[model samples]
Target: MYLAKRLSIQLLVLISVVTQQTTAQPLSNKRLEVSEKHLLTDLITEAISRDEWMDANQLFVSSLQAESIKSGELDNLKLSLGLANMPIDSLDFNQEAMTQLKFSVSQMLPRGDSLALKKETWQQKGQVALVQQYQRAAQIERDVSLTWLAIFEAKQSIALIEANRGLFEQLLEVSQASYSSALGRTSQGDIIKAELELIRLEDRLASLALIEQAKYAQLGHWLGDLESWPEPNSLPQVALKQARFYPADPVHFDDKSHLDNKGHLDEKTQTPNHSITDQTLSKQFVQHPNLIELDEKAQLAQVSMSLAKQAYQPQWGLNASYGYRDDAENGMPRSDFLSLGVTLDMPIFSKTAQDAGVKSKQLALNAIAFEQALALKQMLAKYRVIQSKVAKLNQRHHLYQSSLIPQLKQQEDIFLAAYKSNEGPFSDVIKARIESLNAKIQALVISVALQKQKVEFNYLFATSNDFLLGADLVAPMSSY
Candidate 1:
């Protein structure tokens, strides 16, 4: 009996060690150190810097700059030279037949600041490209962060399963030994069940290995070569930024609100206090890069509309010419002629075309406004949904940490002790142990999921410097 108790104690110690190895790191509060060697932020920075799409966008901005420069030079001075022989014979009383050369210079002056408006429109387009680049960078950061977390989760799950495999092996050994010795309620059936469970654990390990490989492939889309990439052994805790419009103390609906005398709920009492409104969400979303990009586009459209309106005014031209004539047929010298003129084109015949252009631009600008509104609505809705998910995951994580995990662990210990003393069926021991392992894995899943949601939530708060990490927004790859 004393020997049996000693064996049971030894088995408990081994089980405890394995469980500690599996759950300790995930449950700890240690933060991963950020450095040049760190994976998460460094990977994000690298991905943004090396992104071909961002490089292409920067080139587009450069093209816009060229367009802006071109717009400014549209009304520059023009010069021309002409050589011709005067046809004096056709005139009734021509004084001479002469070869003439003419030199002329002309300048077009655009009506009503049209040139300036055109330049400004191109400049506004460049600004929009810049905003979109930053927005794309933020999206890349979110994607890399999520993929990294997924790989980490898979690695940790594999570790937990491998750690628990030792306990399962020990159970199989005990069942086989007892059945061979014809001892204490141990049967061939228990041995078979133990073997089956071990096989299942092996199958789980293989599945997790495949999942980890797939995640690595996904990560490679951003990080490039995975050949030298280190397996993720630690999870970096992402800092959660509180949304600008999030209430400090959120409101909840009160089902027990006092009813009016007429049996309807009081309107004033029914209203939840500290509730966030659509206006507040809109105000927050306006600061996001996606919305800001749309805003810039709208401004560009407005400038274009103003430029189109300038087409209604007349365009003016000024020219000066000096013409030289050779000696006439009678061998007499002829005087050179000088001329000056001012010309303008009336828009009387182009009223329909100009109106149509202006109307088209106006409708485009209005369309941008509608796009902004729709995008804001979608962002607000998505934000609310993710916020709810984060809250629920947090609650579940707390329940696992404080109540479910501990109870499962205790139950596992109880069943193992009972099985050793022949007071419980071997199947009960296996069930309890499986439940405990699953609970631990579930807890880890919740933790990883919470962090991923936080990463995504913080991404919604797009500012110029949000994910820039001190890198220049316009030239993100320069430092690299």
Candidate 2:
């Protein structure tokens, strides 16, 4: 018994110590990142919980029952038959309660009307819930983008390293050959230069290895598994012909307009028009990633207004209770009667608050209008910027493809031929090779940047049709 008690005490002490360490430990930047991720994960999990395919009819029924329980709204009716109208002994509170119940039932939900209205109300609520689902979906998409961006970048860096590896192999062979030829000809200076080249190649390889390790570490953290990481099969090849860009100008975009910004939001703010999908440029407006949420919210605000008006009106419900009172011939009490009743209390006190609530909801609707305007304005600004960038990149791509790149390729070819014929300095051949590598690398970087910009622009401005296909094209192109 003594030993068990001691052990229990030790366990308690250990738990307390652990708790203290957890609470008192200084928060570092690393811990903050972890906390943020956990919060995000939890929010997504909760939002998904609310997204279960609940039956609207059943939920509305349940919600009405819940409201009855919460507000005690149905049980507030009382009997007031007037003191002179009924003698004290003859006044049966139970009879008055029964009459109130009958009146409330016929007035509130009215038996035959409930089923259809219940279904309709919940269906509208479901749309609002679905809007929340879309926002949640967007968050999940953002997470995926973060993870894949890390992986793509990792693969991209690996490809650069692979390219550098090939450079090293060729450099090593040239150095070895130069060293051999120099020693055979008794040329000490050339041998020294070859040794220096070998040393530089080793340094480059080491640096590339470091970069690969860092990228692997980043990917591992995202996946929540330190031991596993993405193993790229091969470096990606660019398919310039498959590129699809978002509209450059959101102010005057058409069906073929590239995604420049989230301009669809303005359509609704300008007009709370029903059938948002049937409006101008209907295809672009239907379930657009950026605007659907706002439009649904506006619809929900209208529902709230309706609910507020309903709150001002009376409601009906039934109640049953059993009670016992002291009423016995032998001076004792016994169980007497089981009472059943229902009520409809006037909204004399509640109408004021209901009015305030309606006004508050109206203000919220106005706020959403302002928010829609802000989103459109910001999107337009973004669209203009991306358009400028896309134009500049296209111009540069054409200039390099047509003029500079072709001349650089010819120069490399001429230098190779001259070197083979022993008519050019070896250093001149090396310079030509370096220039060509730089040009190719620069071109590759710009091409990737163009795609990255397009992906961001498209995500914010894409039409409903610009979905998975857009993702597919942007996916490979996004590997920065």
Which candidate should be chosen as best, given TM-score against the real structure? 1
Angstrom error at residue 137, model 1: 1.2
Q: Single out the weakest 10-residue window by summed lDDT for candidate 1.
A: 249-258
Cα distance off (Å), candidate 1, residue 289: 0.9
- Show where candidate 1 strays beyond 4 Å: 1-39, 75-79, 84-99, 225-232, 243-281, 329-332, 467-480
lDDT of 2 by residue, 331-353 (tens): 44444445566667567887679
Clashing residue pairs, candidate 1?
Answer: none
lDDT values for all models = 0.73, 0.45
Residue 42, candidate 2: C-alpha displacement in angstroms? 26
lDDT of 2 at 376: 64
Stretches off by above 4 angstroms in model 2 are: 1-126, 135-157, 160-286, 314-352, 412-431, 457-480
What is candidate 1's lDDT per residue for 322-385, written digit by digit as tens?
Answer: 8887776577778888999999977999899999999999999999999998998888777777
